[model samples]
Structure formats: C-alpha cells, structure tokens
Target: MAAAIERLLSEISESEDPLEELRSLRTAVSETPLSGLRESFSAPQLRVIFSLLNTNDKEQVEVCVDVLERVLQVLDPTHLVQNCKSELQSGLNHPDDSVKVLALSQIGRVVSHAEGTIEVLNNPEILQDVIQSIGAERISVSKEAIATLLKLSNTKAGLDGLFHSDLLKDLKDVMAISDVIRYRVYELVVELSLVSPVCLEYCANSRFISQLLEELTGDDVLIRATAIEMVTNLAQSQHGRQYLAQQGIMDKISNMIIAADSDSFSSFYLPGLVKFFGNLAIMDSPQQVCESYPAFLNTVFNMALNPDPSLTPVALDTLGLLGGTVEGKQVLHKTGDQFKSVLKRMSQLARDGATDLRVRSLEAITQLLVLPVEQQTDDLLLLTESWFASLSSQPMEMIKHISTQPFPELHCCALRIYTAIACQEWAQRLMMSTPGFTEWVVDRSVGKGKEAKDCKFELVGALLSSPSTREIFGAQNYLKLKTYLQEGPYYVSAVSSVTTEGAD
Candidate 1:
C-alpha cells in the first residue's frame, strides 16, 4: 500500500498530463482501506498532493483536493490537525481562488465530525481564515467560506465555538462589504437558526435576528425585498412561524402590503411581499389569513386586474395556489362577487392575453375548478360549475378553441382545464351537447406533443372514470373512450396493406 501510494505520488509529479495521474491517485486513495491509509499516509505524500493545488489547471486541482479529502477522512483528529491543517490553512491564502475554494471545502469536510470540529475550534487562526474568506472578491470563494462556517455550526460544540467568541464579529465585518455578501451571511444565519431552538436562541442573542428584522422593514426597497424573502423562508417551520408572530413580523409585513398602494416603488418588492402572504395563507388557514388580512386577497385581485405584465402573472399564480385545496377554493368562493370579477378577468386573459399570460390564466382556472373525488361535495361541485360558467358564455368552446391553437403550451393548458371539469356531470353534459367535442377528445390527431397527448388522455380518462359517465355518455361512446384510455397516451395505430405479386 505504501509503495503504491509512493508510485502514484511520483507519477503525478512527473507526468506531463497530471489530470489523469491525479484521477488515478484519487481512485487509488478512495479504494484503499482507511486502516491501511492511516498507517501508510505520511506528510511528504500529503504535500505531493497539496503541490497540485499550485497549478492553474482547475480540474487537476479539484482531483488533487478529492485525493487529499479521502486521505484526511482516514486520519485521526490529532494527526489531521498536526499534519494537514496547516496545508489547508495555507491554501486559504493562496493566490488562486480555486485553491481557496478547495481549502474551504476540505475544512468544511473536516469540521463535519465532532472530533474535527473540536480540532478546528482549538485553532483560532484556521477559524479566522474561514470567516475572512467570506469577503473574498470571488463570489464562489465567499460562498464556499460561508458554507464551511455553516458546517461548523452543525454540531453543538461547533455552534458554541462560532457564537461564543469574537469570530462572529469577524463575520459581521465581512458582511459589510456588500449587500450581496450580507445576504449570503444572513442566509447562513437563518439556516443555522432552523437547526434547533437552542441554535435560534443563540442567533437571537447575537442580535442577528434583530438585524434581520431591521432589514426586513428598512427603507431600501431592494434590501427589504431580500430580507423579506429570507424571513419568509424562516417562517416555513412552525417554530419559525411562532418566532416571527411573537416578534410581530407577520403583522408588519401585512401592513407593508396594505401601504404598498401609496408607495411609488412598491412594485419592486410587492411580488415577494404578496408571495410571502400567499405562502403564509397556504401554510396556515386560508380562511384565517384572507379574513385577517383582507389586503392580501384584495391586492391579489387588484394585481390580477393591473395591466403590468410583471404583476399579473404573480397574482394569477397566487390565486391558483390559494384555490388548489378545498379550503382554499371555499375561501375564494366566499369572496363572492369580488372573486367572480377576478375570474372574469382571468377568463379574458385565457382567451385574448399574451401566450404566457393565457397559459397562466388557464392553469389558475384549472386549479380553481379541480376537486378530488373524495373531497367533492354538491356545494363544491356547483361552485366549480358556476366558476366555469363565469369564464365565458361558452366556456367549453372557448377552451376547445384554444386547444386548436398552434401554441403547444396553450393547447396543453386548455386540455388541462377540460380535464379539471371532465368528471363533473354538467361538464360531461356540456361536452355531449357541444358538436364533435367528444370525438375531438378521443382523436389523437387533434393534439401534438407528449404533454398534449397526456392531457387529452387524462381528459378522456376523467370522462370514462366518472360514476355518471355510463348514464350520460352512452355505452358505445364509453367503450370507445375506454379503448382510447387502454392504449395509453402515446399509442400509434398500426397500418397494413397487402401487395399481390405483379398485380398492377
């Protein structure tokens, strides 16, 4: 094993093409047992691998790092810090950003374990180098440095090592370099806080949470936008939601949305703010969220009506998400005339708007109309039917017309809307009454593309699978539809012709 390691190291140093040699070294090192590696691996051989980092070739350097990390995994904590720590720390200060990234990545791997974390914590210089790397001019290096620090915070000992000392001050100083860097560190803090209650408490005590909150409500629209996104992520967990609620952050965001109408640049952060509330509504109770913050639903409706291309799609998406569940559909249904007006606007967009807007509108309508079989009640069914009616005087024809358009996206979306309503008795009746509508669904030639075929298949399947289909659709048509469904979406019919010899 020792001789093989020596031979690979020598070949790497001497080969004109070191990448292949380095790859060989990596494979050899990885396949060797850790016990054998521990006994045979020496500082000299480690330095030979480290020397590869000095090169300009990125692939070679990466391969070299992979080899070093494999060998580092076998070393006990004592030997790791004693022999390899200095090499990695030196790589942090190397002129090559790739080397810095390599160094930080290996440090991250080292600190992933308890013993490695303890070893790293004992060495303040190594810790300081990592924190300083967060300010590296290259974004990649800075990101890696932040990741290394995040790994350090995974264990309790590592967490204490980070927050218990002045190291965090170093992190703060680097965060001042730019808003981009600041958010990177902020993301790291939020991730750590999510680890446990104790970690969140540590972050709160460090004033990180307060700083994050300040940024969330700050005057700089861009900063506030970024901050609100992070806070929204923080609000995903029950603990996070609880903490934000206790801090009154949720109310503050709601008020921000309420005040957005007066702010000239509200468009900058309005989508994110709306999305935050949209997610909050979905995560909690749609009824409670929309009722408590009437501004949320109103803003969504207003945005849907607004002509700005940017805001309309987001509003459309949020409405679709809110209407995806039974509770959500009920909440929107309760809005009565206001939601109906929004539905009218969505229907108009689905027909006459830009292609993208048309697709989003169709998707939103589908979400609003779709209800699972088990969850379907007469009220819900009637509600969906009414919403479909509100779309157009002839909603089925409008969507069927769309399905024939050249745009595959619009075609699939229109078919999805059909599928959404296919299981309902009124919808099935509408299809029967509409000329050639049932034939169009079973005919594979009408739709193109995998998505379109699948959607048409689903629509047919919905018709055949519904409880009342046999009564309304007739047995002959049902069997034909059943044959279509049996062959699946991608089925191509086989054609044959017999040719008699010399029979012209």
Candidate 2:
C-alpha cells in the first residue's frame, strides 16, 4: 500500500502531464485500507497534490477534488487544514472551478462542526473566492460554494462579514443562470435578507424577483417555496409589501395559492401561501388585499369551523393575517358577518381540548382585538361577553395543562389568554364583575396554585382599584377586596407588585 501511494505521489509530482497520475493517485487512495489512507496524506503530500489545482488542465483538478472528497471522508481533516492551510486557500483562488469546489466542500465540513476554524474560513480574499464560485460554470461547484457560505454564516462574525461583502451583487447574476444552482443560493439569500435591511432592499427591485414568483407555478415544490419565500422576505417591509402589490405580485401569488388545495393544508404550496400572505397583509392597501386574495376570508373561517381538527388552527391563523394590517381589517369587515361566525369558531378553538389547537385559536383572537373599530363587529361587547362565557371554565383547564407538558408551553398559553383578557379594560371589568369570576381570580392568584403557576393576579388587583367596582360588589364588598389583597400575603408577591403598578 505504501509503495502504491509512493509511486502515485511520485508520478503526480514528476509528470509534465499529470492527468493520468492524478487518476492513479485517486485509485491508490481508494484501494488502500481506511487506516492506510488516513496515514498517507500530509503537508508535503498536499502541496504536491494541490499543485495540480493551479494547472491549466481542468480534468486534473476535477479528479483531484473528487479523490480528496472521498479520502477526507475516511480521515480527520485536521491534518489537511492545520498543515496545508495555504495550499487550500490557493485552491479556492485557482482558476479551475473544480479545485475551488473541492476545497470549499472540504472547508464546509471543517468549519461547521469544528472549533478554531473561524479565522481560516472567514478570510476576506478567500471568502470572495467562495462568493465568486457562485457564478461557476458547473452547477456542482456553485452548489458546493453556496453550502460553504451557509456553513460559514453559522457564526455571527462570518454572517457580519458576508453582510458587508460587496460580492453579493453577483448573486443576481447567479440567480439568472440555473434552477439547480438557485436552490442553493436561495438559502443564503433568505438568511441575508432576514438579517440585513440592505439585502432586503436588493431583493425588492431585482429582475430575478419576477422569475422567482413565476417559478412558484412550476412543478417543483422546493423551488416554489424558495421563490415565494423571497417574495415573503420582501413583503416584511412596508415599502416592499406595497411594491409587491403594485408590481402585480399578488396576481401571480394569488393564482398559485388558488392552485393549492386550501382544504388539505399539507399541499405543497400551503406553507408558502400562508407565510406569503402573512407578510403581504402587514402594510398592504385595501384594494390590494381584496383583489389579490378574494374570498380567502370566507375560506379560512370555513376551514377553521370544519370538524376535522387538523385544518382548524392553520385556517384560523390565515384568517387572522387577513385582518393583520389596517387595510386588512377593512378587507376582513367587508366579508360580512360570515366573518362574525369566524369569531365564534375561534372561541371554539380556544376552548378545544387539544392544547395546540387551543393555543393557535387564542392567538387568532388576540390578533382580532387589535383591528380598527370601524372594521370590526358592531357588537364587540357581545363577542367579549361570549369570550367570557367560554372562558369561565378555563381556570381548571389551566391547572390541567401543568402536568401535561414537561415544558409548560400549554400552561403558559392558557395563562397568556387569561392575561390578554386581564390587560384589556372592558374585558377585565366584565370578568371581574361577573358572579364568581373575581373570586376565582383571587383563588388562582393566592389560593392553591403556585403564584408563578397561576395567571389572574392582575385582574383581581385591577377590580379592587377600579372606581366602578361598586357595581360588581357594593362599596362594602369593594373595601373587603382591597383588604383581602393587602393582608393576604399576596401583596408583596411578584404578581402583586406588577398588578399594583398596572392599576396605578
């Protein structure tokens, strides 16, 4: 085995045309036992091996990269990075695309899970080589280049370096080239656009924006999602959202969404459809909202009201997003009282026995509370009263959630809805004045459950402080309420401190 490696190395080092020698070196590495291969490569060998990357022969670099990929899989890459960093850096900058691809593929593995690779991987000149490879002629090289960028982006420092690099301009050039390559670059674009507003601006007016939206209607699920995701990122900004609406983006997106099975949410386009509209509604116009997604308001509510539990929460979420922005509220109220029916359905979801279903429902209702008054039901008081009607039994349910999850997310959600009600003045008054509700709040706050475990401490404090408490309890009863809070040892509690501050 040593003789074979020695001969192949000698041939690769000595030959004027080393293509055959490169192939022989690969054959030697593969034929060797795993331990033998691990022992064979070092700084001296790597310099000789990597020298071919700078050669004019593409086939030599191609075979060398392919061989290194397989050999590195069987051995610790520390020897490669620690001893031959300069050789690898040279490979990244080599004129040969295959050399750049293979070196980066190796770097991707090294930087991701290993410590101390930050300095080697984040070199500006080297990073520019990786970025330049995004435009490589071969799709495999470009894909590996993107994979390396994403792995490097795992660190905050690397992400910062990438965010400031002027090389991202080539990304548009990359986007115009190949669908297979775009798939890889889209992941980095998503990461960059999410973190930097500057990248978001670049995403807005780029010519490839239309191509991305067009790809949504194509046969590939992942491509459609990536494209819509780019649109979604743009939609996150007020200017971007309005720009999409103006540029007829909604026309393209709506048609794609219409192609999806809204009833069966597991359909390929469902997630992108949901996420895109979520951002679309953020700052868009009423005309834009109504024209793009007609009758979706009716669709989501009907799905949420469906007996099948699976679709209810997602449908409820999409419904809330339709009312998410100022104009979205106008679009929602225009749906008529088929809309009011959604409120009842959301209430049903809040009371659902399934914890996740219930949490999503409460989130939807919480969103509803923020809509403009003219764009809401004429009878919010009735809705609030009805919410209290369903909520009256929830104290016991909150306690039930504690033991169900080791994490307490369900428990915390129930408490969130309970607190959501407490924070609103009208809802707080209605619940406190209701017979037995105030007493339950007091019990939940100071009685049995740990103070941290319970949710209603503030509502009880608010009632005792409100001048209108004379209606819920006579002035005599109101005085006792303050006394109970003050002397019951719940006063100095953390809940009491927050509750007292909110009332004052």
Candidate 3:
C-alpha cells in the first residue's frame, strides 16, 4: 500500500491530468485496509497525503481525511501537527460549507490528540477558530466542536491552556447553550474543578457554584442529582463547605432530609444526600456534632420505633453509619430515660418470634451495651441477668439455634460483652451449668476448631478482675483450666509462683 500510494502521489504530482490521478489514488486509499495502511505509511507519506488532501478535488480530499483519522494512532503520535493545522485551515476555506465544517472538527481531534499540542491550541488564531467552530450556525459542526473542546478541557495542560487562552469564558458560553452539550459542559466543570484545586479556588467565587446549586432544584432529575454530586465534592473541601454553608445549604439539606419527599430519594439525589450528611458529621467539630445529634437521633429513633419492622433494619444501619461517633454517644446519653426506653424496646424485639427482627434487635442491644461503664449503669446488669437465666434453662435445641446462626459480627460482639461480664465466679457458674463450656470456649478461641479453648487465660482474666469470682475459681472445679494456665501460652506459671510466694 505504501509503495502503491507513493507511486500514485508521484504520478499525481507530475501527470498532465492531476485530477484523474488524484481520483484513482482516492479510490485505492479507500480500498486499502486502514490497519495495514497505517503500518505502511511513514511521516513523509502522511505529509504528502495531507498536501494532496488540500487540493480542489473535494472527493479526493474527503477520502484522504477519513483515512487520515483512522490512521491517527499510527502517526508520529505527536509531531507534524503543523501540517495538519495548515491543511485544516485550507479545508476551512473551501467553497463547500460541509467540507469547511468537517475540516474544523477534524482539526480539533488532531490537536486534541497531538503531543506538544498545547502550543497550537493556545495560539490566539487557533483559539479563535475553535470558538468560531463551536458557535457556527450549522448545529452539527457546532455541536462537534463544542464536544471536542469539552474533551480537550479534560487534560491538565489542556485545561491550563484554556484558562490562559480565553477558553474559560468561552466554556461558560458553551455551558449556557442547551441540549446534550450542556451536560457535557457540566461534567467538564466538575472535571476541571477536580483536576485543579487551584482552578476551583479561583472559580469558587464565580457564579458557577450558584448556577450549579440552582440546578439542584431543577425539575430534571439528572440535573438535580448532578448538582447534588457536585455539591458533595465541593462541600468536602474546606473552601467548598465554607461556600455552601454561607449559602445556607446546610439548613436546606437538613430540611430536605426531614421532608423525606420523593425528590430527595430520586436516582440523582439520594446517594448525594446521604453522602452530604455523612460528610457533615465528618466535617463538624465534636461540639457542633453534639448540637445536631438530638435532631438526627430522634429522627432515626422514631423510624426504628415504628410499627412496621421492614424499615427498622435499614433505618438502624443508616443511623449506625450516620452517628458512629463519641458525640453521637453523647447524644444517646443526653436522651436520658428515652435511651433506656429504646434499650428495653430492643430487648423486647430480641424476644420477638421474627428471626430477622430478633437479629437486628440483638445488634442494637449490643451497640448500646458495648459503650464504656461510665456510659451505662447497673440497670443493664439486671437486664443481662434476666436474659442469662432464661438462656440457662432453655432447651439444647434453642441453644443450638442461637449458636449456629452464622453472624460472626454478632458472635464477636457476644464474646467481648460476655468476656466483660465473665468474672471468675460467673465463669464457674457458667461452666457448672453448661458442663465443658470452658473447653468449648478454649477450642473456639485457640484452635482451628469451631469451639473455644479451655485455658486459665480465660479464668485468670475473669478471676483477677472480679474479687468474688477469684475466690470461687480457687476451688477444685476449675483445676484443669488452672493447670493449663500454669503450663500454657501466657507463661502465667513463670510469674505466678513468685507473686504467690510474695503474697504468702
């Protein structure tokens, strides 16, 4: 193909009938497989091809243009951009208006992909041509040019060139032009702002943020959703947050959440809304977080307290995600007796016949109990004692049902909570009642086995912490665990004798 095209170019450059030779070459180039053709053509071949493409023969020029685009990946990849620019400028001057527009759009793509392309794009002459192409009355040409500009704006250097080349204000013009290009422009704003925070800082005081925020209330769901997402990113930055908060966006979003309307849950706004509030919790100070806690907690608590069980789990999980903080814990404390009421309610739900509700109820109870002792009172001890006594008499079948359920998170929570309570006496009572329970715990704790290990590690931890339980663990019933502790992992034996002799 390269030899054939070279022969044809030579023939066309010298023939008495150049047009005929150009026509024949156009046909051959059109028939050539684009992939194989690019591999064959050198940079010189492309320059000669571009030279012939600018000829008066429109069909020859058009075919060359089509083939040129398909072969772009195989081109110099960066150099010889000036040749394409000159040819495009010549094509733009053609008598045929469609030919002119095609030339302009093609020029944009070439420049967009060109290495060292920024120099050409930033030139006042080329910048004017790009803007003129975008504003052309021919909708197809104008749309193509605008789309190309938006894509070009995605690159850091390209965006920087635009900012320096009067392209920024020109982008605002394209953004104001409606239709599909509007979304493209909106996305460009987001990309542009995200890529360069310095650009965003500069644009922060501009009308762009206001324009985008106003779109949040637009009737179009996509626009609202995009606006929410944009606000989310913008608000995450300290500058963005300061800007939105000054605009009263914080109050507006809170009210929107409270309203709980259809628009808030629409495809575009829902994730944005959740992210917005979630980010708010992250952004606020502990004091500020505490101040807003009651409103958030009451809203979630009422939803959890509702008669329909379906919303309870979703609301519980959402609330957990939202209030996962010390300040949130403070909110729970401030709710006073209401907090106690919710705990009792969870206990009731845990006792309910529905397994799913019981699981969620158990989780909520675990969350409340996992807090520090300073955060709770002895009232919870009575509650646990009641549940423990009930479990002690329950059938083995019932115990299996509780233990076999595959909630590892719940199991870990149970381990931590139960360990917190398992003083030596309580542990002895547990072992006596369950028989081989310490062995079960040890097997699970230490082995590849599903059960726990029986070691003095558990008993020692329990005994040292609870004075009464220590006295009970000193007796014969716990002798095996006591022996294991003397022989095992903690080297409790290595320290125990010296400590015991001192005490003696």
Off by over 4 Å in 1: 1-6, 11-43, 55-82
Residue runs of model 3 more than 4 Å from their true location after superposition:
1-117, 123-160, 163-197, 219-226, 258-275, 290-294, 306-314, 339-403, 406-504
Ranking by lDDT: 1, 2, 3
Which candidate leads the pack in lDDT?
1
Q: Between the candidate structures 1 and 3, which one is better when assessed by TM-score? A: 1
Predicted model with the maximum TM-score: 1
lDDT of candidate model 1 versus the reference: 0.86
Q: Give the candidate order by descending TM-score.
A: 1, 2, 3
Model 2 pairs whose backbones collide: none
RMSDs, each prediction? 3.1, 13.5, 14.0
C-alpha lDDT score of every prediction, in listed order: 0.86, 0.61, 0.55
**lDDT of each residue in 98-150, candidate 1, tens digit only:** 77887788788778878788888889889999988877889899889878888
Could you tell which candidate, 1 or 3, scores higher by lDDT? 1
Using Cα atoms with residue i matched to residue i, what is each candidate's TM-score against the true structure? 0.90, 0.54, 0.48
* Native RMSD of candidate 1 (Å): 3.1
